[model samples]
Target: PADGRPIVELRGAGKSYGNVRALHGVDLQVFPSQVTCVLGDNGAGKSTLIKIISGLHQHSEGEFLVDGRPVRFTTPRQALDRGIATVYQDLATVPLMPVWRNFFLGSEMTRGPWPVRRLDIERMKKTADEELRAMGIILDDLEQPIGTLSGGQRQCVAIARAVYFGARVLILDEPTAALGVKQSGVVLKYIAAARDRGLGVIFITHNPHHAYMVGDHFSVLRLGTLELSAARSEIGLEELTNHMAGGAELAALKHELATVRGVDVEELPEEEDLTAPVPASSEGTS
Candidate 1:
């Protein structure tokens, strides 16, 4: 955690289940005050990589390091103790629980002496509100069921909770996958806010637009191996999308599928063509 050292780094890290290889030769770097976006499609080994980083699974090959020191975590708690936290896509909140309750779910503060410990209701609620507000979140009531809040608000709550718990490195799994455009934008803003607060973030998502908006570095995965790695300045959003889609291979497959199916591969309409009428044959087909 000293100056110029990456907070988390994976060197040729890999995972396997018996003869089934889930990942291979993966290299990832996450530094303080930066967002490292991991882009991959379904079955591209993104899940496996996250598991290794979160200490849910150990790498079968190569090394996993934290703060430039090699470490092999046997459990997620060990990782958490070392200041690495993963916020999974599900958001991990009980729908019926109040927002403040969800925020302090497992790690609630206790009052009074030992053995007779009781939940410090007022303090926990006040701290939760303060933490959320610090992240630019404003809720009408912390006592409302977490399910009553929007998806973006819930995600922000989870993020603020992690940061408040002293997480030096935060790993987010597809944080924007289920939200609408406006809601997704809201979550993205907090992601940038988290980075601004000097936390190293590992953002895992298939959506390039969301990743590009906040990522300072990118690592693209394909079939359990790293295919590309670059800083934000070295790549464009279009190129990132192409890589995730397998670039020319995906294009070739699309053409081949179209040819084999005897369907014309029509070009997508331009932005200016929104008001134009579709051709009679193509109408209602697309």
Candidate 2:
């Protein structure tokens, strides 16, 4: 069942590096079993926001809350200890390792007499397989290197691993940025699966289309500041895309393009089809 309350919240959060400000008074809330999508262009402070939420960097200002209780973390481990897990674009998996090994990369299982501890490979493999299947991921070669799987498959494994490890909040950075249409669909499905299982999912991506597909809440960032934040019911896809592209900026761009190309701006293609695809380079990190 969905947890109706927010698991994490940031009020007036800010960060800086030397003289340059990376984030400015950003406020966000992540509810359990709901997908909160953060959309922004390059240099929009998206990375800085992720770092702050995932505990890689402390905000210089504002309140950080966990379950409405004020809290602060000096390190990523501290956040993870609170059941917050960050799955970055690279995903933090070793491609050459087997699926099971990657599933339990940092937290491997061990069982034996105290003096002769040994990895419980069989048990780990069985658990990994079952968990992946439960997430609707079907992989025939559990023993194969994780690199053999597609981008979406690797992401599913990473997400399933986080759930298996008892993560209550999962932060994903562009989980589907580097896949074909079909592959991106697969990743989106798994994201929904994770949300359905009651995890607060903070999904950071530049692609509004992907965000709209899985997000229940939307936050747009531009020039190191939050542009808009609202529930899904409050806005439609066109509004979301316009906001993400700098609503006014996009309008100007459209006019400029039409003028330069000698076409009627109003006669341009349907706004519905103008939604851009996820960038190829936006693929998750390994």
Number of the top lDDT candidate: 1
TM-score of each: 0.90, 0.88
What RMSD does each model have against the real structure? 6.6, 4.9
Model 2 bad stretches (over 4 Å): 1-4, 250-286
lDDT of 2 by residue, 1-286 (tens): 2545689999999898999998998999998888999999999989998898788998988888998898878899989888998988887888899999999998889998998899999999999999999998889989999999988888889999999988999999988788888888888888899999999999999888888888899999998899999998998776787777664665667777875756667765454445544556334321
Give the C-alpha lDDT of model 2: 0.86
Number of the top TM-score candidate: 1
> Candidates' lDDT values, in order?
0.87, 0.86
Deviation (Å) of 121 in candidate 1: 0.3
Cα lDDT for residue 118, candidate 1: 97
- Which whole-number lDDT from 0 to 100 does residue 203 have in model 1? 93
Evaluate model 1: give its TM-score: 0.90
